[model samples]
Target: MNKELWEKAVAFHGHACPGLALGVRLCEFVQQELGVGVSPDEELVCIAETDSCPVDAVQAILGCTMGKGNLLCSRAGKTAYNFYDRGTGTSIRVVARRNTAELSREERRRQILESPLEDLFSTTEVKYPLPETARIFKTVTCAVCGEGVAEHMARLQDGGIVCPHCFRAYDR
Candidate 1:
């Protein structure tokens, strides 16, 4: 990983934690594996298994952002990521070593920042389709909450569009 890139990541993530360092290394490995660099647009997609400090690094270095509809989170609470090339359909999954969990947060961060690439993570190639629903959505106004909701996320309740939150409220 480039020192300059790590600096940039630290600047973006607002700290120099282990998760951020791991993400920086993951981005570097992914770029090398796919023979590509930071995406100019939606050329690459990152599916992170958890919402953690590393996610910010992936966003900064890989050019996959939630606003762009390219960064997806799995909410699995694991430090794993899947990088997919939209143009070639190639993807790779990277997971941090489980033993890292044994270390204190500060020690883990220190190790991640100082360790070699191979020592920090295990990676594998995978095949998975980018969902059609991932890219496009229609915006609608929820009648109950009056908040804007994606059409796919809105439900029809009492002959009016309602967001999941509002719908759940009605249910309760």
Candidate 2:
């Protein structure tokens, strides 16, 4: 693991923890195993199974971010991540193993950092199709809330265009 990259990830994440270390290691493993580099664009995509600290490491190292629409959250509440390379059509799913042994916080962090990729995660080829690239939808004002929303996200409610936030389910 690169010390500089780890420092940057810790800084970005506000603090250091085992979870963050796992993420840093996971990204490094992907780079080495896949021979891929930082994404300048949406060439790399990460569908993280959790909204945890590790996703932050992935965003910092791989440049797959929510703003760029490359970092997606599956909210499956698992220490798993699915990575896809749009350029090569290669995809991988990495599931980090839980450290069940009783250890102090610092000890746990050190173990995660020092463990080999094969020991830390179960990596496998992704079987599903990769998600479509981010789209640029036109913006339209919601008639109900007078708020601007993506054209595709606008909902037709009571014959009026409304944003999802302002749309209400009608019974009649």
Candidate 3:
């Protein structure tokens, strides 16, 4: 990984750690495999399985961010990330291997950064199609909260449209 990229990841993530290093390595490997660089648009999409320190690295390095709707979190609580390059119609899933050996935080981070790509992560072709690009939906006021929400995300409850945050299910 480039030292400047490492510094950028560290700066974006607030501090350096093993998780962030793993993410950086993953991005580097994916870019090399797909022959792509930081995406200026939605060409590079990432579906991360965990909301961890590494996600910051992905956002910083690959230009995949939640604001752009290219970085989606699956909440699987696993150290896995799926990258899709819309330009090439290529997708890969990279899962970090668990490091069981006890080591200092700095040591673990160094190991992750220095280790060969094959030793640190398992990569496979993604079976699913690329996720759709972000769509702009009309905004409607939530019946309960009176806050504007995308129409597609509004839920119907008690015959009124409410935002997901204000929707409640009947116990029955």
Q: Which candidate has the highest TM-score of all?
A: 2
Task: Enumerate residue pairs that collide in model 3.
Answer: none
| lDDT of candidate 1 over 1-172, digit per residue (tens) | 5899999899999988877988898888788778778887788888888999989998888888888888888888988888888899788888887662688878987787777877878886643457432457889999987899989889888899999998855434
TM-score of each model, paired residue for residue: 0.86, 0.94, 0.93
Residue 140, model 2: lDDT of: 94
Per-residue lDDT of candidate 2, residues 1-172 (tens digit): 7999899899999999988999999999888777788998899999998999999999888889998899999898988899998898888898897778999989999998888788998887664468898999999999987989999999998888999999997879
lDDT scores of the candidates, listed in order: 0.83, 0.89, 0.88
Q: Which candidate order results from sorting by lDDT in descending order?
A: 2, 3, 1
Instruction: For residues 1-172, write the lDDT of model 3, one tens digit per residue.
Output: 6788899999999988888898889888878877878978899999988999989988999999998989998889988888898887888888888889999999999998899988888887663567899988999999999999999999998889999899997779
- What lDDT score goes with residue 143 in model 3? 96
Better of 2 and 3 by lDDT: 2
TM-score of 1: 0.86
Model 2: C-alpha RMSD to truth? 1.6
Give me the displacement of residue 137 in model 2, in angstroms.
0.7
Model 2 TM-score relative to the real fold? 0.94
